[model samples]
Target: MKMFGKVDVGGGLSDFWAYIREPRPHRWAVWGVALALTWVVFSGVEQYLIPVDRPKAQIIYFENWTADRSAGEIRADWIARARETTRRNARKRAEYQRFADSLGIEYDSTEADRVTRETLGEEAAEAVKQRPAPPPRSTLAERAARGPQPEITD
Candidate 1:
């Protein structure tokens, strides 16, 4: 019913046009100041302001295969077999039995490897000294705990 306030939503553009249409120095100076301030505000916002729609990275992720280790017992059978390969190494079989007996658990290659490493101060690389051993057992727990076995390289 009544135009109460100077709330022309898009009427500012006509003022801009009016300023540019006249050749008065004051109008150009006003236009120049507005242009500078607009650019300053815009650049400041663009440089400093982050977008709301930008996907905020909740977690930075990276993957590496090198540092991984077994989540379960390392294979014991491979070590036993490796020991068996050498003439005096059959004694490793007896060690395996003894370890299992001591632990009150079944003789598992994984467990044996763990025992060798933890108890005997050894690494699985000792068992597969010069050759690649067979693949690890395929039981569910074994598969879950087992990591990628190192290849016995030349």
Candidate 2:
């Protein structure tokens, strides 16, 4: 006994063509259902199986902590950091200016630089103004004398 009949690929295709060519509303409905099913299956596979683009984990260093540094040293470090930040911003501005020039865009570099400096100065002043004053030594002694207090709960 033959396990399989002769493969008739063109016959199957012709039968499919005939089925599609029939003037039946159900055929279009079946086609729409098939399309929807296929879309759902592909979407499920893509959602569950495919690897998506993701942002890589970043390691950010905010500052180098020093225990023995004086206030003068801290002030100097802040000044240096400010200067570096200004230099970096200026360099970026210059690069942008060059790019704009290449694209025939009118950019006033001097004016931009002046505005940037003014913004940076204002930010620095605001930060300094907002700096919290250290608690007085007497206040610290009083807190120490009070010891640990009971935690407040709602």
Candidate 3:
């Protein structure tokens, strides 16, 4: 006997081939019938039960919350709101005008009416420079006339 045993790979594969050569015709027919029945059942269920696709715009809906409001009511409300805003703006403008006036800025309308450097001249500037500086001291009589200063307890 040889040391290595003879392998029979070819014989095993040929046996498998011979089994496939002898086929059962009924097996293919049974598989075909099962596939046909499954397809028919699925198609029938999909046709009647499932909804068709539609545009998103048509499917979504919205209702106006202001539908019950009358035209006159809307007009009146807008007019009142506008009047309030106008009043606030006018008050702010008036306050700014007052502050500007306190700062010695004249609101001259015409270019000819506006004050200029030539009007004051060099003589007025000289006179201002020659005027003596006032004393820093505040007299007791002056303080008394103005009334007593408020006392801070803290």
TM-score winner: 2
Clashing pairs in 1: 73-110, 74-110, 75-109, 75-110, 76-109, 76-110, 77-109
Q: Judged by lDDT, which candidate is best? A: 2
Q: Which 10 successive residues of model 2 have the least lDDT summed?
A: 128-137
Looking at model 3, which ten-residue stretch has the lowest summed lDDT? 109-118
Residue-wise lDDT of candidate 2 within 1-154, one digit each (tens)? 7755688889989999997798986887898999999999999999888969889999997867788999999998898787788767766866776677666567666665665566476664454345344333445678889998899999
Residue-pair clashes per prediction, in order, are 7, 0, 0
lDDT (0-100) at residue 34 of candidate 3? 94
Look at candidate 3 and tell me the lDDT of residue 81. 75
How big is the positional error of residue 124 in model 2, measured in Å on the Cα after superposition? 19
lDDT of 2 at 45: 92
How do the predictions measure up, each by TM-score?
A: 0.23, 0.33, 0.27
Candidate no. 3 TM-score: 0.27
lDDT of each: 0.59, 0.73, 0.60
Model 2, position 122, has a per-residue lDDT of 68
Q: In candidate 1, what are the lDDT values of residues 44-140, reduced to their tens digit? A: 8887894456776798688743354563423564555554453243347556656666555565455544544443344444653433433434667
